[model samples]
Target chain A: MTQTPVTDSAVNPQVAAAPVAVDVPMMRLHVKILRFNPETDKKAHWVTYDMEAQPGDRMVDVLNEIKWYKETGLAFRRSCQHGICGSDAMLINGRNRLACKTLVRDVAKDGGTVTVEPIRGLKVEKDLLVDMEPFFDAYRAIMPYFIHPTPFPAKEQYQSEANAEKMAHSSNCILCACCTTSCPIFWVNGSYIGPAALVQAHRFIFDTRDEAKQQRLGVVNQNTGVWRCRTAYNCTEACPRGIPITQLIEEVKREVMFGQS
Target chain B: MYKGREGQWAFLLHRISGLAILVYLLLHVFSIGSMIFGEPFYMKIHNTYDFVLFRLGLVAVVAAVVYHAFNGLRIILMDFTSIGVSVQRQAWYGVLGITALATLYALIKLIPRIAGGY
Candidate 1:
């Protein structure tokens, strides 16, 4: 057998140790979620879940993973998986945001936990889904659908460039209800027409094709309508679509006050 | 007139009465500034106070001012901290109760003075 010479340095007791080959497992995310079931329970509870999330994983992905692999009873509302759907809005770390657009890595960047709760100012139906009937009711009460004058063909209504530009900004409402849910006025007075409905009313009031501007203005002129807004600008901040809700509401108030529309 | 929603009704009433009080304040300031002209102008305007309608107008202005002041304080408190939002309904009721009592006291005192019996 051939003898292999071992170096004295390799066998030395005081030699600097080679870098520790410790296999550190990737960090896991601890999501503290609020859960409620009014049909069966009297109070809400917090449920925790450990999710292994990658750098680019979104909140929707983590939720879907939990729903599919961990707990079949977990429930949430999601659609389109894009920012346009506005269905996945929930409170992430005490702020309302669309779950489909929030990156998990950014939220859990410091290797800390994240908390998810249902949007405030609405009745919670399940884990993360809120009953949006009140929100949509306010939207419909404002007459969101277009109402143009009669005696016109089925073709597109002719609108000048200036007219189109006037109504363009208010036309970006996606009916997300995020702004409505985030508004303090709506939380206090459910009868208040809210920012979403007021913005919708402004949309029609500014549109050149709409001939019922006066009637719409009359509808919003009631005590619970545009007057209820205190211009706190919370709705504008909570809007994920970046719609200028406060500006539109202010313009509508100006028009109503001056009787210009 | 709104029955079921007392809090909302109170808010609307507060705003309406606040605006009324503001308008009345502006008019009162303008009328009082007429004193700069001399006692003749002051007496001319002050003599109108002896009439019944003018007395009633004084009462209305007083009531509106009292209610608006109390409600404005409540709103200011609401803006100062989140504590007011949590107890907003209670705070509103407190303002309403205080305003009603103050208005009643003022009316009692004013009616006697107007009748020249105080």
Candidate 2:
């Protein structure tokens, strides 16, 4: 191999012009939040914050980043980081979704702003946390606990696989109240016992082990009970666990209307 | 009863009011259906509704109608489009609150008429 001598200007050239630095785009997120102070403000207001966000970041992550790193007064509820706990359900942009499950990139897809607010209908405790008592009240009113018929046998109470499959969907309720909150019927009347309770009631109504079907049906037969559901299908649409809430409610309505098993 | 967060309650109330309206409508239809039996039977049934219990039922039905109709419009907006769900709580509160005030005014005006002031 032969080596050739190179010129200084050709070899150096100001160290190749400082290696022409290439700029990589950093992730940026703009969150416009609805803020209200029950103690100080007479009305709610919109507040926007700029955030540094990554592609995998969930809405809950952005909210925490804003609270811990930017604003200390931000308020919202989140129990389990995973979607199972159902504690972080909120309005992201405009739809009802669990904050922990929503990706910030998807929410800001249009290069537009992202908006966060408390779930609708309940009283706001602060910025993002709203009172959740009414939801549970409706849940409890349906007598959700299982009421077994006759004494338990020495062996495990058996259900055919088909029967078990029949009740499987309604049994998946996490008591998240997401379905109940999304229901339009529940939105108009607080006393309607809502879909969650109706779904719970249906769980036991179809159970061969449960003997209190009539009693349970009677509770829901009131002026503000299963009869209220219009089958809007919003509950089914909003359910994170994919529970068929409207189907169960319709079944319960049938049982109540017909007074059958 | 669980307080069920704010949005949950609004949703619950919407369902309740909707059901109330439905029940009231059924009763109204049944009551009016008696007209097919001729005016005498209809008049008899209509006259029975002059009692205080019936009047109270009317008031409830009216309130339910007002709430359901107003809240229903709100729900229609929320469900049919993308704009209303974010402010759903506010829209619900706004509709029901205004409807309640209007219902109160209507009741105040109606009571005098029903009480034989006319």
Candidate 3:
């Protein structure tokens, strides 16, 4: 990657000249990955793979090296190879993060070890692959799509900037389940609908054009809904999209309590 | 990874302090309620609590109660206020600061009493 050095003689005549294109030095990183094969192995185990990685190499690149060069049997879920797909969310060093987005330098401690595991609170199917059905089920339960039950007008339903701004961050969620899987509450109670579902509900609940605010709010207002969130803020921290999930859930809680819709 | 910051610790400490208060409450009721069994029983119960370990436990309980009470208010503020969620970490430090001050105050008042054995 081409990077302008912080100190360059071009900018400051007194300073020594620095290279315009500075290549990131490669460092050896020991990746300890949680491995599980439901058919062969009754339990999960850790397998460490030592490899050289550039500072800016993504976690997915590290996993790809293990799967392609070291061990051909290594398995993982990755599609877009970018953060947008949200298919590669995993537990990186104890936090839920998109594997494709997290750089090796940021996660690796002084060129030491980086632990990779399937996101918790879900069934592991194989190495680095967790069953995402439960995560998606919660997402589906929130009625994620826009719903306007009544007949629509002839023209487009234009939304105001203020109204759109309210649901802007919530809509950015890619259903990654990073927030939901990282939640301690969801780790034990799988039916709590989790933060992903709540964010989805928030997106619809706050939309000015959607008529299903009460319907959507009612779904999230159950005993296992917004009230279950203990304001741990783990969801807020675990969100790969940087969505303020805990605040959204709290807003939903207030709506449920006061019937604000 | 599990490197949770101030918010995580705040939640964990809040839960722990709340449970500590509950345990202390149960012990308090049982010990104080020993008065029903007459003077000898009440005296025995009170004397046992005077032990150094038990005295230390009482101080810890005071700290717990203070932390729990202040953190509970922080949680309530986070639930209702517009700026509370944004500035939650600062509010948590405030909660911890108040708890520390209250615990220090308790220590100042109780140390002399414990030392004098009165």
lDDT of 1 at A19: 28
Per candidate, native contacts kept equal 0.00, 0.00, 0.53
Tens digits of per-residue lDDT, candidate 2, B1-118, equal 2233455565566668788878877877988999999999998888877887767666666777777777778666654444554565577678778877877877787786568632
Q: Model 2, stretches more than 4 Å misplaced?
A: A1-26, A259-261, B1-118
- Model 1 regions more than 4 Å off: A1-27, A153-156, B1-118
**lDDT of each residue in A1-261, candidate 1, tens digit only:** 001123422544453332222342344788889988778778889999877666566788778767755677877888887888789888887667788888886678646798888887888888888889988888888788778658887797688999998878778877778778777678779889898899899999998888788888888888989888764556766788888776677677767777654
Candidate 1: give the clashing pairs: none
List chain A TM-scores, every candidate, in order: 0.85, 0.85, 0.89
For model 2, state the Cα shift of residue A220 in Å: 1.7
Model 1 residue A79 CA deviation in Å: 1.0
CA lDDT, candidate 3, residue A147? 85
Q: Which candidate is the best by DockQ?
A: 3
Model 1 chain A scores worst on lDDT over the 10 consecutive residues at A1-10
Docking level of model 2? incorrect
For candidate 3 chain A, which ten residues in a row score worst on lDDT?
A1-10
Ranking by TM-score: 3, 2, 1
lDDT of every model, 2 decimals: 0.74, 0.73, 0.84
lDDT tens digits by residue: candidate 2, A172-199? 8777777777666666677788888888
TM-score of chain A of 2: 0.85
